[model samples]
Target: MMTFAVYLIVFSSVGFGSMNINSHYFNKHMEKLLVSRTFGLAGIRNIEDFWIFAEGPMLDSLFPEPGEMDGNIIVGGPRLRQAKVQNNSCEVHSHLKYLQDSCYGHYTISTEDREAFGPGTTSPWVFSHTGSDYYRGLVATYGGGGYHLELPSNKIDALQAIQALRQNNWLTRGTRAVFVDVVVYSVNVDQLLIAKLLVEFPPTGDALPSWFFEVSRTSLFSKSKDYYIFVCAMISMTFNVYFLLLEACRLVYLKLTYFSRFWNYFDLSVSIGSIISLRFGIKNYLFIASTLDKLPDGVDIPSFEILARNGFNVKVTTSIALSLCWLKIFYFLRVGSSTLAKIRVSVWSCVLNSLGFFMVFVLLVFAFTHLAHHVLGPHLHEYSTLGATTTSLLRALLWDFDLEELQRSRPVFGPMILLVYLSLVLTVLWSIPLAIFARSHTDVMSEISRRCNLWDQWKEMVWGQYSYRQGKVTSEEELRLLLEQEGLTDEDMAAVLSRMGVRRGQHVDSHHLRNALGCLQDAEMLPEVAVRWLTDLKQRVDAAGQKMVALTDKVHMTLEVASGDGS
Candidate 1:
């Protein structure tokens, strides 16, 4: 338990530090982007909308005019790139189909292509900036590719760069999506903040598709000289390794029986997961930091999308492992406390017994889901698909349904259908599991009580036999001598004897003395040291009694020899 506490402390410290640094960077960049007018680029479906956003307001208010900014502003501030499908011949039946089909073949334009186009070039891929000229060039070559547009620090150069991309067939049917990466470096803290904006084109949408934006941050000196983090890492690794070995030894000792216990699985999983989470978390942090440091100049800046994804993976894995670690605390508590142990048994039994009832409940929900989907799918958006219908029905079971909306969709049937679902699921299906758990809990409590009574009876019987044997070996004199040696005065002995229900001068055995000592201890009349002295004195008195008997027998034999010699 001490080891577990130390490990958790170290792990939490490292996790908190990393989270603080990353969240600071993320929020700083996200706040700026959220307040920017150009952040609504996700709604850009046409060239007119794109131009309105690009030229209307600056990307970041802090650096409204890139040319006016101090040298502190990083050179790799903001850039744009687009991904296009290479093979446009695939027959896309729906929006989902288009997404999946496009995934099979898409490519972003390389850094070399952008560099070759040179500054002020109208078209990067072709001689002319026209759509026909670009199409002709694509057909002559590999048929399709993406474009990289570099927006220099100066406002004029940046606007010119935007014009170059806008003149081409960039937002055509072949285009999959456009990405805008904005990187800002804070000289005060030496931290790099990044924001990635993704704008995807839908196959069949009159309104523009909603855009996605992700923000992340990393520190420059974090990886280099944080000795505290290094120490935490070493300590965490050591504990994880120790736990893994301990679990492995237990598995070997228990063999297949080890899997029968649920907490054993938790033990093994948390150990392995902690190790992997830590390893990858550190590796990804360093990798992202290094990538940010080596970012190329011009339009050739590398995508931070993959690096951002790696960081997200680290967060998710670490969260799961840490949650499991905390949950394992309950396992230890359950083992140490009888009340918790009984609760665990009752809950587990209830789950096993309610499996059949759960199956029926699921079937009922499934049937209602299909019924709602078929009936209201055409008119109501909520029940448009099977998945959506299931969600709506489940929500309705929890009284989250809108009766007005349902009635508006289908005035007569909608309310009736919901009433039936709620009545059956809430009144019938849910009640069975509750009853099962209640019954299991009662049975567990009764069984524990019966076991407790039986245990008490067994203890009483064993102690009775022990007292009988002790009475045969010890007597009143021996008890009195031992009590005196234990520092009991004559008055104390008389009072103790009175408490034991012994009359004046009555015989008292070792069993009676034992009972007296127990009463004194319970009443706080006897200290632990006195009890130990009494125990030692009792043993010494018994040994002395045996020696006296042997000596009396020898004297009697000597007296018989002397009598025979006189005769």
Candidate 2:
């Protein structure tokens, strides 16, 4: 059993890493760059003439000189790689870039990096050393406890991916600045860092400023197989839903459940499992992250074999997800000897439809990821993590994001991204009123249906009672009496009168009474004739009012004469 579980884990992780995640080395390199750039939780900016990245550095000496600051500070695009050593020192490889930096304010360099700096720590610290060589600065912080021997460039790549996904952690700096664990990115002139800060860090038990959330952390280097498998499971579920819907529609159209039977239980097991994987299985094994990298075109290179190894968490999640898909595809599809086979034909087209729907989930994920990266800007991973990547994908679908200040911390087009998202929000908001109207209509219809049944039943009991003169009182008298006995309001009494078009002393034509009673809750439950009986009785009451009044007057006159004779 353990072996089987292990196999599943391995299968899932490997698949997710190789297939779902970008397999190319080039993409990984780009991710390295993206993650680092975004690490400036303080927020960075790119100028037309130059890209200005700002972060709180432990050693200020790492920045480039004034002369080198002009023009493009980075000579070439970043050279991305994993770190060789842990606890890499901090170096601001200025090559002369900080000359005209007007972006940052004076802030204390929180000295907690030593305690928090390391690989896979729950809370990571951005560490540094005052050195000119980017490589030297990198080595001081890479490790299992680190800035693990991963390059800062990799973080940049992660950030780039985040940006590509179109949402971000960017927000404006308010009266209280966002707490950013701005680590110095120490990389060679070739744009490669010897070490990178770990996403998770030790908080060092220090109480950070108000914007502590800005301080990003690293996550475990989990296998991607589970994520991929989970994704496939979701695709399968989406397809299953489509198939069932199609089969149901067909069944309704063709007047048979034969075509729809197969899909009847599609959502019953596989879908439930898929849902489970989506919520927990995938979550346990994989992480979502925000990155600053743009989508790389080619990813063919194999850079790090060790990093490619699947982790346990990655394996199990993937296996379970794939298992869900397999059950739907193979088990359910092949189980024809069972009685449920009768509906196979009806469900076949729907199965095809569901598979097609899976494509939609895939396309949507890609499309939104692309849009997010492009509009949100490239990720600068100075504070990126693997978990955030998955989250960004979800955000694109949900369209709920907040990054206004990060965009505004600097004067740039970054803040404008909110406008696009806000426009979408407005469109959704405008539709809400219509949605509410529809909901109200359904509720009203349902309520009336429930109550109408009771009305219908009551009407049958009273059908001939009034017409036969079996009841001594008229409907109006009954109405008044019912009010006293049945706890009715003046409103209820008024509605009955209004329906008949009858005033207290006046009689209305009985034609409209049936229509009014038909609108009641119990009408459907009663026989059709009962409604007519009430209608006919109302008319008799209106016509007989004068006769009843004369009788009352005669009785009163007799009583007065008797009283006089007795006196």
Identify the candidate with maximal TM-score: 1
lDDT by residue (1-567, candidate 1, tens digit) is 777878888877666656656455544455444333453454455646655566544344425555745323544546565544444434556767745664222333321122223344443443221111111111122112346555677666776766766675455555555555566555655555455555554333222333323334555345544668767877888899999999999989999999998788888898898898888777876876677566554322344545555677777778888888888789668755767777788998788678878888899899999899988888886897787789899888777888998899999899988988888888766688888989999988887665545444433533464465565535556555655754777876677566566664666565564574455422123343344444555689999999999999999999999999999
Instruction: Name the weakest run of 10 consecutive residues (lDDT summed) in model 1.
Output: 130-139
Candidate 1's C-alpha runs over 4 A off are 21-51, 54-63, 66-79, 83-148, 167-169, 174-176, 187-189, 207-217, 220-225, 296-303, 368-430, 463-470, 473-567
Query: What's every prediction's RMSD, in angstroms?
Result: 15.4, 23.4
TM-score of each model, in listed order: 0.65, 0.24
Best candidate, lDDT-wise? 1
Task: List the candidate 2 regions with Cα displacement exceeding 4 Å.
Answer: 1-263, 266-268, 271-412, 426-567
**Candidate 2's residue-wise lDDT over 326-391, tens digit each?**
455444444534324423433442454455545654564455445545544334221133334346
* Model 1 global lDDT (CA atoms, 0 to 1): 0.62
